[model samples]
Target: MKERETWKNGKEFLFSCIGVSVGLGNIWRFPYICYRNGGGAFLVPYFLFLAMVGIPQLLLQFSYPQYSSSGPAKAWVCCPLFKGIGYAMILTNSAVAIYYNVIIAWTLYYLVNCFTLHLPWSSCDNIWNTENCYSRTYGLASMTGNTSSYNTSIPEDQNLKTNVTLSSNDSKTATEEFWTYNVLQLTDGIETMGTLRWQLLLCNFSVCVIVFLCVFKGIKLSGKIMYVAATVPYLFLTILLVRGLTLDGALMGLRYYFIPRWAELLRPSVWFDAASQVMYSLGFGTADHIILASHNKFHHNMYRDAMIVPVVDAFTSLFSGCVIFVTLGYMSSTFQLDIDKVVTDGPGIAFMVFPEALSTLPFSQIWSTLFFLTLLMVGLDSRIVQVQVLTGSLGDLCPGLFRSRVSWTSAGVCLVAFVLGVPFVYQGGMYVLQLVDWYIASVAFLLIVLLESSVLAWLYGSHRLSEDIAVMIGYPIPKFWQVFWRFITPCCILVVWVMGLVKHKPVTFGGQAYPAWSVGVGWIISLVPLMPLIGNIILTLLKHEGNTMQRLQKSIKPLPEWTKNLRSDQNSEQNGDILL
Candidate 1:
């Protein structure tokens, strides 16, 4: 493996963590999730999830580096039988990274087109019409998100006249709108795959260059660059928020954002969804933060940084919600269009929405530049971490890729990433991303986390971790956090996972639900890690040795603290013989 490159300080380390953790998901998805679930009201459930789960889990992932002194590989060893969880994480990270760059390419394409004031995907025809022309965003060639549903829902398919009014109580929507669109729903998944479809290819090419250059120096330079790179999106977001709020429809978007239907909270699924959103928004288990943690040198107050990263992340989500709704509202009110029709676009929205929004401003061109640039930066923000995670994961998988010091060259990484990514350039690429997201975030991440926490909090012991942190910091993690790590966090995910399965109705947003077999196949699509975990269990049992505990301990090389004072004390007599 390449020599480990540690961080200069917590500030730089935290910044890079922020760079990855607070990416497009927060800026794009959160606003819409908030808006959809009841704007300001969404915050209630969101904060609830964070308080009950996200915050503690964030602290747990951060605390993990300190404990393992390893990346995902080392981190997974914290659990007894779940040692292979790290490998699953690495796989998930790398897969996500490839498509993530595809998104950045989307943002860049729009940015370039902004100069021309020709936003692709503005009119539904851009998508409905499969054309060779650049003006129509989401060219047929670009296989971005869910083209199957998207293919079926072309603007031409929607018979509603432009600016048609159909609703009695604001439920009116474009003829073929996907799930729900609000400020958050509208722009979160901006169509980088839209008009000027060539931009997706071009943008990926540029990002591949940037990744190679930035990462070539390894984490040392990457961390320093992150100090600036991470903060740029917020700067742009602030400008957009200011201008967007001042425009028409901005307040309406904000109204949708802040006002929540209390009834939504009553649904058990709502809280479950909020929990997923927290995981998705915070970048909890994607191995993104672990890479950052690996680069960071240990500190006495690493816990403080741990706490701060999530707070900053959540804050960005909150502020970003305002920025988006304001912009969406302005777009909605200005075009004299129904807000719902404008909400749930693929590329048709991104190219059309913001360009259309900026058109209303005094210097629409300049604002267009900032807005696209900000979108690009927001898109860029997420892309970098995906790269970092991929690099880290690949380094784990193929140590030969960088056994010693290796050149972080622009050319090599670009070629490799592009070649790997080109398959995604095909029609089914977006479907793959959805499958990966479900498996990785919903399954691998949560499943591993549930297992990890169970071992740490139950078997390994949270008190020991508390003492370890306390001894290091001269104070312990608050009892609130302690309870969280031990119980609350895992239970919350466990519930979500269970409910997601038990009540797992395969309802489609637009099309007919897939048959049971297809849905079953979808579940297995990304559950790659389960095979290894189950295999390990079987192998351990087949040994005919002792119990799971004995077989696991036998396999692992002992650390110096094997019989450390942590375990052999209070609870030893009960689980002692079983464990040792």
Candidate 2:
């Protein structure tokens, strides 16, 4: 076998980390989480956790790949028993990559339609719009009790409560109808497969092609693409922020975002949300950090990279929140609605609310096009990292399969991802996306992180790991970081895990409960990645050449491939001091 490839330089690795760490979550999830928790008060816990838990955990994971010079799966070579963590990461990432592309396809679908002089989502005249479709002016007028009369012609069978009607007080906005009826063509529930969405399938195929071309040459081409991908989103964000601040009620939105409700600090859920957000936003436990750092030169300053990436991610989240809330503030003022009514998180904010707000702006088409394009770019950067994690890990494990023809291997991976994502293009696909997202992306992620920390800090020894990191970075490891990694961070993770389980609620979409079978399937998806870990333990006990205790100890021993020079140096230095 041949030697593995390292990043050409530190900048390429930094940009790649930025591309992976800063993702759609920062744009969509963080703002809403802030708004939902305690507005400005949420930042207290967020920053606290970022310092105590986020950066330390990130540094811990970051050091492994660079020190071992291997992907997440292979990075566990030191303690082969926990190697399942790497396999679990691969499984989790593969599942995420499949559904995540579906979102990119949705963004592409929206982006393509954004070119017209009259935005499709701005008017209620389309086939998807119902009799109840209302403009911002109409909504504001309705809120003020000066509602205009309009024809309400509808069949009794279609007179459902959820259906928006002109006669009803609650009417659906054009953008809402566009997202639900036009873009998604969503079914009533997950039980129905409905029909394939041809448009979305085409977009998904296009996304696959774009991803393949960008990374087909591996990091050589991808590293250069990272320069554009990592930096362009900020430019787009700055433009949106300038435009958003100029809108009426922009101050009110900012007030809602930063003005803390001090009482919320007492709530445990707020603290939990803050901790969870740090983990999610920082890309910890996803193994993307490990895989990306693995490509860095052996002596690169990953300690510095870890610190820089999380700070950049937090800044991006704050910047994105400002941009989003400014638009939402305008939406609220235009409709004479409260900020809470106008604000939403996840796909609702990105696909529905933001687009609705954009329709009312001057040069609506231009702004709308830019907004969706921004989404496409952010999603594209994240998707590239996810693809890299899978391909990189596989390349590490099976060199023969990928080494001779890296481009072919990459194309094959993209094709498989596209095929796996097809079910999400069906009318009921959104439900599948929601199910997988809720189960795999939340508690499962934290559990994986907790296990990884335990194995590394306790089993592998944080002191030894610190010595390795110090040697690589040419600096002494901070005392606080050592304490955080060995104790504080793990305790914090356990608390968050327990809190999440206590507050766990059944997954729902549009306030509708999922069928039991679908929920069962979701749980199954969550456990699938964990299967390897369980199997590895059982096999270690059964197959190893020793008694139970001895076999268990043997399983955790460092592999011969783990770098031994640093540990040997530490030992030699100690012996030399004793001799003196």
Candidate 3:
């Protein structure tokens, strides 16, 4: 048998974790979540959840891979029956990688356009623009109708008097038209898988190539690349922040972002949003962290690594939120619209609203290029980790097939992921992306975390896990963490899971409801990860040679390969000396 690979050093592992955790979710999703939940008031529950749930859960996940020296698929050696959790992680991450790359492709497309002296989205003259397209503008002219300079030939449906009365809401901004018409070429709804856009396909292909090159040599090359990928966003964010704050209405946006609405803290939905955001932002319940941490040396001080990474993630989110809302404030002031009018979530903010905001700045083309490049880096960094999780899990499972040709295995994984992502490049791809993001990414993640916390806390025993961590970190386990891992964290997760179930609504995009069958498909995507657990249970029951109870008990016992040291450590602890 061959030996498993380990990260070159502690710094490499830390950078890998940061690369995965601080992703598009932090930049695109966090700001909108904050805006919707309660502006600044949401931070109360968000930080609370971060302390009670996020940090503890991060520690648990980090411990598993570092201790076992195995990827998610092989990390669950402690309870072999729950090996399905590992498989679920792999499958969920694979599904995420598919649609996630499409977003990166979109960013890449925008990045390529930034090279032109005039941004394509800055004008309404393109074939994709409609008569209703108007550049984002300022002064009384934008509020009143002085759009004759924007629209060359007004439609005959409206006379000159009617045209003079038009408002900012009457027509789509150039950025909106560019996103809906030119970039996405979005179809009406999820039911229609319209013709594939060749440009997007090429862009998606290019993104796949970038991901492959980054990881083809495994952690050696990827760790070096992560040094740049993980650090560049902060530089871009700082530049954007400085520029955004200098714009008019910047203070108004900052007030909206930071001034707490204390009443929002009393709402159950706000707490739920806070919990979900922490999970998503930290990459919890996903295989990315587990697989990346699996490469750490046996005694790597992941306790410190876990602490540092989540803090960095939270800071990045707060920083990104400030940059986004400040720009939105500038946009709102420029267009004579409310700040809320310009603020949106997910791809809406990243692709449309922020681009519109960028157009109002001096050196608009340069700013536009920098903004999309930052996005491209953010998305690319996350995609690399997801791809690593998939390929790492496969390599761990079939060492003989992959250990000799790590680069080839990585290429194969990227190829398969690229093919899977093709559907998302179609006109209806955004709808599909929304569906996957909702069902697979959101619900499946909650379910996995609930199961993982329950198993580790109750069945595997939190005290034992804590002692193991203490040995590795050379410090006693904190009492607060013990309480969190054993009781508080799981209780909080259950509450969030129950709330998600109770508040569940049918998947929709831009107010368009999905057809029944399409909703069914979403459910199927959500359930696919759970199938491995069910299949594993039935196989164990059928194959084991013993009474039902005995066979089941035997199946759940720790595997001999990775758990020998763990068992020995436990035994030595009973003898008053724990082994690292």
lDDT of each model, Cα atoms only? 0.60, 0.83, 0.82
On residues 500-521, what C-alpha lDDT tens digit does candidate 3 reach at each position?
8889898998887999998999
- Which pairs of residues collide in candidate 3? none
**lDDT at 448 for candidate 2?**
85
- The segments of candidate 1 whose C-alpha lies over 4 angstroms from its true place after superposition are 1-3, 117-199, 345-352, 360-362, 393-403, 408-416, 438-442, 503-521, 536-549, 552-580
**After aligning candidate 2 to the native by TM-score, how far in Å is the CA of 533 from where it should be?**
0.8
Task: Kindly report which residue pairs in candidate 2 clash with one another.
Answer: 132-166
Q: Which is the leading candidate under TM-score?
A: 2
Q: Where is the poorest 10-residue window by lDDT in model 1?
A: 179-188
Tens digit per residue, CA lDDT, model 1, 158-254: 2222113223333222212321221112111212222222335566788788777777666777777887778887888888888887787788988
Ranking by lDDT: 2, 3, 1
Global local distance difference test of model 3:
0.82
Candidate 2, 558: how far from true, in Å? 0.5
lDDT score for candidate 1 against the true structure: 0.60
lDDT of 1 at 243: 81
